[model samples]
Target: MMESIVDSMLAQETPAPAGNPIESAEELSSIAFGFMASKALFAGLHVDLFTLLADGPKTAEELAKAAGIPLNRIVTLTTALASVGVVSISDRKLIQNSSAAQNFLAKQSKYDFGDYLRYQIDQQMYPFLLQLNAVMKGDLSDDAIASYQHWMADEEQASVYSESQHAGSLGPGRTLARKVDLAKASTLLDVGGGTGAMTISLCNEYPDLHATIIDFPNVAEIGWRFVSEAGLVDRVRYIPGNAVQAQWPGRQDAILMSYLMSGVPGEAVADLLRKAFDALAPGGKLMVHDFMVEEDRRGPALAALWQLQHMAFTPDAHSLSVGWLTEAGRKIGFAVDDVDNLIPAMTKLVVFAKPS
Candidate 1:
């Protein structure tokens, strides 16, 4: 009797909903207008809209004058921004940072991710989302190659993201800069360090620690410019070369691989860790910091997706497991400890040490 009842239900055929086509149309319309959101956000950044709104709400004329956008465009930009609730409009007048923007978009928050958003948008990750079809067809899109070569050149030079290391800056590198222990080590080698920001931060923190910034010649030039301007030239030395092929020239009490090693092949990551292990003094510590993944390779959807993209564009791109890294460091005879959630929503840090 139960089998017969189940069969009856299984054999039933339902008609498609009458509103399926309308729902499909609305979805397509939403997809089509998504870029409007991109422009609104970027234009907001371009015009210092967030900065202007920082103080208080302003009339459209005041906002336009402050942001330098034309008066005619102000209404449309405001409407677009407000539609997303970048501002609140009561009495048809403007106010700043409606709840969502106040928390995330404002320049003052620890969560100031707006710069990164605009950077990715202008850097073509946002624009390139539309060209996934082309990318699937092997187009080798600009965003792919651009950031790759940008890093590839650094990898070529053994440079680190040093300049990208300011404590107050807006990313994992900076986050790592502020928290990672820079003391107890007098000589630090920042391999593939970009901008020398990390070195600068460490120099300030440890006072005794001096660092070398190595990367591709051109990128190192930029790092040099920054460090010079930053008045850190005496403490941080910039070296131009490739990390993979060139022998990183220096011995140290400790070595930092901050936010480096992403997209490096599994074997190469092992090799690099081994190299750093050998370079460390008998009791030196090696800090391996990057966007860490869950041990099961789940959760933190964006970082996991990024692990794949890191592989997709670069020649030897891939992510390392923190567990695997700790195990490998142990195999090389380093005492290892895992520090989870160091960078807040971006990375977990792994620490490996060689006893003297």
Candidate 2:
């Protein structure tokens, strides 16, 4: 009777294969195995396979020698890299970067963005495992890329950030950059700009525009180097200052505060926003770019995850919704406008035109 009951249940048409319970369970299992995928990638990155291959293809044995890791580990790393689409194997030899790897992981590549993952391996991702604790309790740290900054300067991060950050990733600054008619704006100030990558990109794109990037002392030095390297020395200036206590030099056409907002308490961010607004000329525009949550705060995946990721560095680093920002602007004496999503993503530019 039990067998007959089971058969009867199985006899009912299972719709699409992907929709079937068995398939769904398998899909969930695959999702649960995501850690293995991340570990495989980390192992490949740990050995400098992508950086080594940046020059040209090399055999797994050669990679093992260059990376100073075990031969057995190299085999696993190389094969895993290939499986993960970061490398390609041709004729039993491990080739150099696959297109994706070259673009983001290869250190030498102009579009390299591997710095984003350095934190992943530094065990900073360990905190993310404590995400629930963060949500229920509070953040885990008091610094922004504190360990990472300890290792590399802002220029290092900028070099990688410039080429790799696509049009609309998962944040606000890039969104504002795309939406603004940068050609019309003559001057821009990137407050706490990491390495002036975004500002310089704007200046390069708009011949008439000039920009200034401000950050910590060392990061400012790096920003200057990037500006000089880009041959934007005359156009983009670097100001070494902290956004917390430093007074920004205003009187500019526009200001960009991106990615920086979420790394602090809500009150602190508001203070900076107000300060930025006060610094702006009546006709100037203040552009605020940061992650914005939905009305419910349960989100578009990546942004939701980012909320947990900001723990310890910035107390109330939750994603502020559009409504929240618009209201904030209205309370202050500026008009807040939401830049439509030209690219499909979570990034939305909030433009607060100061009577311009």
Candidate 3:
């Protein structure tokens, strides 16, 4: 009787839901196993799997040989990628790169973002997130919290971080160039600019504009190479020191603090805003771009996650919000001209203007 009842239940056909599935245990499971998915992507990128599959479909054996990964291991990696929709497998045992992988992950593609993923996520963030438990418990030492700055003091590591970060910053920099108006501005300041990506983008957009970047010595060294490559050396220069401590060129037409405010301590953010206000020329614009939550601080999932991620390195990092930034800029005697998303929900661009 039990077997008959079970068979009857299995045989019953149910209509599929027309819209999104309801929140359930599956959502919880997906969240719990999220790290495994991240690791799978890292592994595939490390092995150059996407590049191998970019040419065309290949059997598991062919991929193994081409990627120089063992057959069994390649199969395992490909299977995981397939499950994540980046790799597809057919009954004939052929594996192919999904459109997402072919366009963004393949080295031959112009939009290849593998470097950012490999360096920032795999090398840096992966290990950093491992200390979340200790960080939350307040068990970490001051040296541990300051480790990121110490690591950046090394030229080699700084180069690696800046190079990958430059790749990630270029798109947003170009976006800023298109969206923000700087036609009247002649000089600009890029505080904490990494690799001068925004400077290059803006310089490319406005032929007559010149800019100065303030960052660490090692980062400036790396950034010079990028500026030279972009052929903007004549227009762009660097001041190698802490941006807060460095002597900023006074009476600037514009100042940009991309990814700057949230990376520093709470007090430092206010100081930077004041410094930008002081440095800008009358009628100059200060563009502040960084991860920021909405006013209520309830959640924009990615912004919240990025704030948490930064905390893995910067224990005293400020919790940024658009409302707070606007209020701070107002307090510093600047008018908030515009506020909009730079990278959708992840970051915002707030333009503050000094009265002419």
Give the winner by TM-score: 3
**Model 1 TM-score on a 0 to 1 scale:** 0.73
**What's the lDDT for residue 196 in model 2?**
70
lDDT of 3: 0.84
- The CA lDDT of each predicted structure is 0.64, 0.63, 0.84
lDDT of 1 by residue, 265-356 (tens): 66778788888888887777788777666676654554565565555544355566677778777887889754655543345678777878
Candidate 2 wrongly placed segments (more than 4 Å): 1-36, 51-68, 79-99, 107-110, 119-178, 341-346
Screening candidate 2 with a backbone cut-off below 3 angstroms (N, C-alpha, C), the clashing residue pairs are: 139-312, 140-312, 141-312
Candidate 1 lDDT for residue 173: 43
**Residue by residue across 1-356, what tens digits does model 2's lDDT show?**
01222233335553122223336776898778867777777666666678888888888788888889888888877787677677889985756788877766777765454655644333454444544465456444444334333423555544443323322222233334546776667888888776676676577668898887777676666557667887988888777667556778878788888766666667776777787788777778877666666666656445555655664434456567777877877777878755543222333457888886
Give residue 118's error in model 3 in angstroms: 0.7
Give me the displacement of residue 275 in model 2, in angstroms.
1.6
| lDDT string, candidate 3, 237-299, tens digits | 999888867889999999999988887878888899899999999999999989998776765
Candidate 1 lDDT at 203 equals 75
Off by over 4 Å in 1: 1-39, 65-73, 83-85, 98-117, 124-147, 150-179
Worst 10 residues of 1 by lDDT: 1-10
Give the deviation of candidate 2 from the true structure as CA RMSD. 10.9
